[model samples]
Target: MPDNREARAAARTDMIMRTTLALAQETGYAKLSIEAVAARAGVGKHTIYRRWPSKGLLFLDSLLSLNEPALDYPDTGDVMADLRRQIYAAVDLLTGPQWGPLYQALVGEAQHDPAVAAGLGERFIRPQTDKTVARLRAAQEQGQVAPGFDLDLAMSILSGPLYFRFLISQEPLTRDYVDRVLDALFAGMGPRGPADAPASA
Candidate 1:
């Protein structure tokens, strides 16, 4: 009986999250509400409230549940290649129709709401940044990256431009742009040899 109860709870949670995403996709985040989610999910408002404290958090959880797998970093031993692959996959997901607008809405909300901003940093940004740093550490161990390089700074440098284009400049995030960023990053961060030494003036 206990096992059955747990299974039922899990199923209901899954259904509620999926319903939330579907409604957000159709009506957008600005129009999404707990009442709508509860009605569409066939659950009491209290049920969603018990699971999530706010609409922003509920939407954040739903977005991560659906899209986290696609954003995972690869470990192909070639750090640059792996980073390239993972970043391209991320760009595709972020710019795609399913979650892009929803994420944009969340980011907009985060600007005005401290709770949403904190949740975004803690739940999404920090985890992704940690994963990136881990990958860079692995490359450092393998001598692909400089021993003394700041992995955290490298992560920011790598992601900063993309976010700038994504959120600020509103420019297209193309593969060429990704390649250029990687090229520039690796040029400075990759293992250096005598040939890489700067020429005397």
Candidate 2:
């Protein structure tokens, strides 16, 4: 039930997205360009421009297209257990063979480019953190977390260490690491004594 032009357009879009991601993974952000993408996709620069205004937009779109089905926000009631699952899934996605370099490239580019930073934060990072925060809020309501616990901080506590290991430490992000991160976050977010504080390790 699809029109000829629409079908062709969809196919072309798929071709362009795949080519864009392939080039991004191969050459990284600095060398990637609309011309290169169009050339690799066997399309015209004008064709790409008609769909996306800038190479950055195309880059973000390509990442989002690939990211759509991977990370599902969890809310299965048991706060620590759910967070563990979510964090492990995130670590897997970010440190996995196919997506790891691409994720690192996008995040690294975001550090240098304001547009990329905004795009990645607004499109990718914010949504993920928001989902995590929502999950925390639910846990707070259920009395699993402290009343004054900061959802934003909780999100950072959960995700920050993974990204640190992933991007900064350049170390292996493993299941054990995820477990430790969750353990530390739980200790911090759970009911604490007067002398309690978040564990950095």
Candidate 3:
């Protein structure tokens, strides 16, 4: 059990993270200021500075903390099904009510800041991609997926449509959209079988 002091510290951190997200949502990150976040969080400026060196770092932490740990992926011995579950989780993050705008802001920031770009790639994007890659490799080994399929390429193929929808198309992402993407990618790359049909026309 955490001591009272420790629990209070944890609560303060959570407050800060939530406040930062709300602030960013209301006014863009470009206009965010440490003084404002500290005032909103009800903490001193030094307290915020003690935890993160810059606003970008603080935003990164807030984004990364939103993820329910990666080990939450289910094995289920069916790699395609497992991948679908994971992809659905991604869809939830991209299109879900709380985190979607945060993701959008980070992507936009990454366009200008090389450091933010690198951090977002390493902290946010790659971990998610790596999970899919591992699932693909496991599926291949289990003989559920083609042995010759390229994991990186396959991951890209699986993700390309989702990113296109989320970033490029500027439309609301839906469960139906996710289903179509999974169906299309898996039909093309998954092992040939009677269970498979021509992907959604």
In candidate 2, stretches whose alpha carbon ends up further than 4 angstroms from where it belongs are 192-201
lDDT of 1 by residue, 1-201 (tens): 569889999999999889989998898889999999999989999999998999988888888776674567889999999999989988887888886788888898888878889988988899889999999999999999988999999999999999999888999988899999999999989998888889999
Superposed by TM-score, candidate 3 places the C-alpha of residue 172 at a distance from the truth, in angstroms, of 2.8
Worst 10 residues of 1 by lDDT: 63-72
Off by over 4 Å in 3: 1-14, 44-47, 66-71, 192-201
What's the best-to-worst order under TM-score?
Answer: 1, 2, 3
User: What alpha-carbon RMSD in Å does predicted model 2 have with respect to the real structure?
Assistant: 4.4
In order, candidate lDDTs are 0.89, 0.83, 0.80
Which window of ten consecutive residues has the lowest lDDT sum in model 2?
Answer: 66-75
Q: What ordering of candidates by lDDT runs from best to worst?
A: 1, 2, 3
Q: Write the per-residue lDDT of candidate 2 for residues 108-139, one digit (tens) a residue.
A: 87777788889888888888877888888989
Q: Using Cα atoms with residue i matched to residue i, what is each candidate's TM-score against the true structure?
A: 0.86, 0.86, 0.79
Clash pairs, candidate 3, are none
